[model samples]
Target: MSDTGTPRMKRPSLHEEIVAEVRRMIVDGELAPGEWIAEMQLCGDLGISRTPLREALKVLASEELVLLEQNRGTRVAPITFDAMLAQFEFMEALQMFAGRLAAERASEDELERLNAMHREMIRLHETGDRSAYFSLNQEVHTLIASAARNPPLFSVHEASAGKIRRARYQANLSYDRWAESLQEHGEFVAALTARDGQRAGELLSDHLRRTGIAVCSALKAFEDAGERAPDDRKGRAR
Candidate 1:
């Protein structure tokens, strides 16, 4: 193929790979919130030098996934209850808007794709594959956002979505909550499939609100049981 006709594919750079790995570690709870990040240990584990690792850390820091301290060292950004609630509140608005637009503008193919993903998500949930289910769950939401046909809105929603990914995963930690969330998704999909913009928006907003309350309650329970340190609940990390 001619140079103009052939697409140039660039593999992910080492720094980008490291950034994604570390971000996944944080989101998957492999690195807990408020826990110190041991630079040397992480370097040894990833088989990488400090330069690329630090570069990756800088990117993650910008994403608010990790905190870089001057002397105290880096730590995973803490997810305080208040911060979680605030994020959910912000996301509620975004998702509601997206849902309404998606319902009105989504193509038939987009709706079919969503239905396929939802079916697989249900299967994953049935098999108790929480991890896979969560991944598909995020994709389902993303598809809806994209279907809205609003670039600016989708961009903002995606950025904010990354920030609260861990919390969204945590929402399904409880079996009851997981089931309830699944049912909510069923209703949401139905509304979107029927092109009921108002109903879809309301359902999505309500889902986010409920998710926020559940996560806050779970955090409070953890605090009460001393699972999380008292200081962790004081304030959110910047």
Candidate 2:
């Protein structure tokens, strides 16, 4: 089974690769909000067959990063600062609940892991490495959620958090803001270690709510700089 007189090669799953690449494209703002994506073009762009490309599209749709239509193909879900605000309200409650549950249930090892992530986050923030800090941001939330020892809660939290990648990155514009956020995260882990449910919940809520405000501020600043995004009136409702 040779092609071109050489051994046939196996490749990593194209669907996963394509989906990851497309997701990165979306997150980096290369694929702007409300912009339609063409199956043929994406296949061509990635030099993959249509089958895997379609599979990747389905995966992206499930993640709510892209919306699919039977006839017109797919487009990115529109983003709105208003949605960011609403998400903040919902996420504040979700994370606070998660924190409370974690305080009630977290094992010693899990609590240590949570504290370890916070320390690493603090270190990353100190390096002023925005990209590294972003990755650590994800690790922090995930660690807390897993520590809660509730699969349903963890799944819901992950789904909600997954949908807001852009908003979080946009929030990191002000250097002081990120420092304050790291400080808050450290306080959260401390509260968790003490098994202080109420205090942990408060810190978690304040963290997400502040992140929402930060993203909104970033949006406003971008608009002020002549970067015009749709007014969200015509965009996705949430």
Please state every model's RMSD to the true fold in angstroms: 4.9, 8.1
- The sequence of per-residue lDDT tens digits that candidate 1 reaches over residues 40-65 is 99999999999889999889899888
**Predicted structure 2: lDDT:** 0.76
Q: For model 1, how many clashes? A: 0
TM-score against native, each model: 0.84, 0.77
Q: List model 2 lDDT by residue over 1-238, tens digit each.
A: 6756987777757676788898877765667667898778777888988888778879888988889988888898766677777777899999899999999999998888888877777777766666766776777788889888899989888767766765554443466777777888888889999999999999999988887777777676665776645322111100
Highest TM-score against the true fold, candidate: 1
Q: Runs in model 2 with CA error above 4 Å?
A: 1-30, 44-48, 69-71, 220-238
Worst 10 residues of 2 by lDDT: 229-238
